[model samples]
Target: MHTSTEFLLALWTLAVVEGLRVTEVVVPPFLVIGQRARLRCHFALEGEVLYSLKWWKDGSQFYQFIPRNDPKMVVFSVAGVTVNVENSNLHEVELVDVQTSSSGQYRCEVVAEAPTFNTHVLSANMTIIGKGRGALSTSAQFYLLETVNFGTQHHPYRAPWHALP
Candidate 1:
């Protein structure tokens, strides 16, 4: 037994609470091994407070940036990879000295502040390209390059065994 006005109000409420949505995720199609690249994320909510932003590589949570946290940003180590959380800009993160292992789907998860706690996730794949096959081969190439050049010329794109240090 609901009045017409009450039912209309209920419909309006339903239309407004449209959870969370990730607008876009921007990542370079390919990254040069041993070079740095930034992955950008954009999100929006109907009308909710932003709780935090979290980044994941290959479905594993590696970094989280919470505005309310003491440190504001926290990171976890991944094999053959380095993660630097950019606090000033909440849109992107700098992955320094990338490696082959860095090739994977990067996800940006947006969580709403409390109450509803709705979450929206968006992901994009990143590819790492290098002349050498693997880390070992890349290291060998570097050693030879150093010996041949006598430490004269430096290649910025060339990565060592542990490229993502």
Candidate 2:
């Protein structure tokens, strides 16, 4: 009977160990292309968590999400991508207009100030699938500006004889 109890205890310990892997963070696996999606990072600690939280891609440096005026964290709105952030119990990162480039491994970095500990980083990987069957649409501005430009002669407010030499 004692041996059976010990075996059960060992099994529970193994389960706990598997559950608490301190490496990569967990985020939603799937997101639609050309749409907004959120990535979350959560850390577990006993005491206060006063630290500078940051994010990065590949081997780049830290990324700041707050204080919009910071030049290091420029508000970049590319043709196919946009980034926004929110800090709370879990850090929420929004990726807008996701494209093929958005599908990659991402990292979440944490620096604990009060504890004076070295920086800790957590990673999460994702894959963005293409929208099938003409799911994506092009912007209308392309057709309006270059292809459908109306000269002043045809304009409703401009008189046709005004520009005649």
Candidate 3:
């Protein structure tokens, strides 16, 4: 008993709901044992409100962000995963002293609030290598060399040339 105009309006409403989408999930592909790893999850809500943001490792939920909750943030204990709550939020999670066991698939889940309640998930793999095996690639080495600041502007320090004489 619905008119064509009413059906078209309903379709238009759904089309413009502005559902949730995960823009990017950044999980470092490689990390040296004992190093801190920062994982970031970027999301776009369009016109929707965020209901919750969660992080999972190997299918285990480790961190959550609920905007309406009193505490707003919660951390769960998972083997090989240590959450640095101090530096973690809806957009990023920091893991301190990552170990070899930390290697796993990291996933970010975002859910929108209210009538839409749309959800999006994205994941990336991370690996932890022993210190000896974590040598930087040639390109990475060159990047470090090019961007490293040896000293303050008042005391500029060059490389081998500075120590030559």
Clashing pairs in 2: none
Best by TM-score: 3
Error of 2 at 135 (Å): 7.3
Model 3 gets an lDDT of 0.83
Model 1 Cα displacement at 11 (Å)?
Answer: 7.9
Write down the TM-score of every candidate.
0.67, 0.51, 0.70
lDDT of the candidates, in the order given: 0.76, 0.52, 0.83
Q: What is the C-alpha RMSD of each candidate to the true structure, in Å?
A: 12.4, 17.2, 11.8
Off by over 4 Å in 2: 1-24, 65-81, 85-90, 133-165
Q: What's the lDDT for residue 43 in model 1?
A: 84
Return the lDDT, model 2, position 90. Answer: 35
lDDT of 1 by residue, 66-98 (tens): 888888888887775587654324677888889
Report the Cα lDDT for candidate 2: 0.52
Q: lDDT tens string, model 2, 117-136?
A: 43566787665555444323
Give the TM-score (vs. native) of candidate 2.
0.51
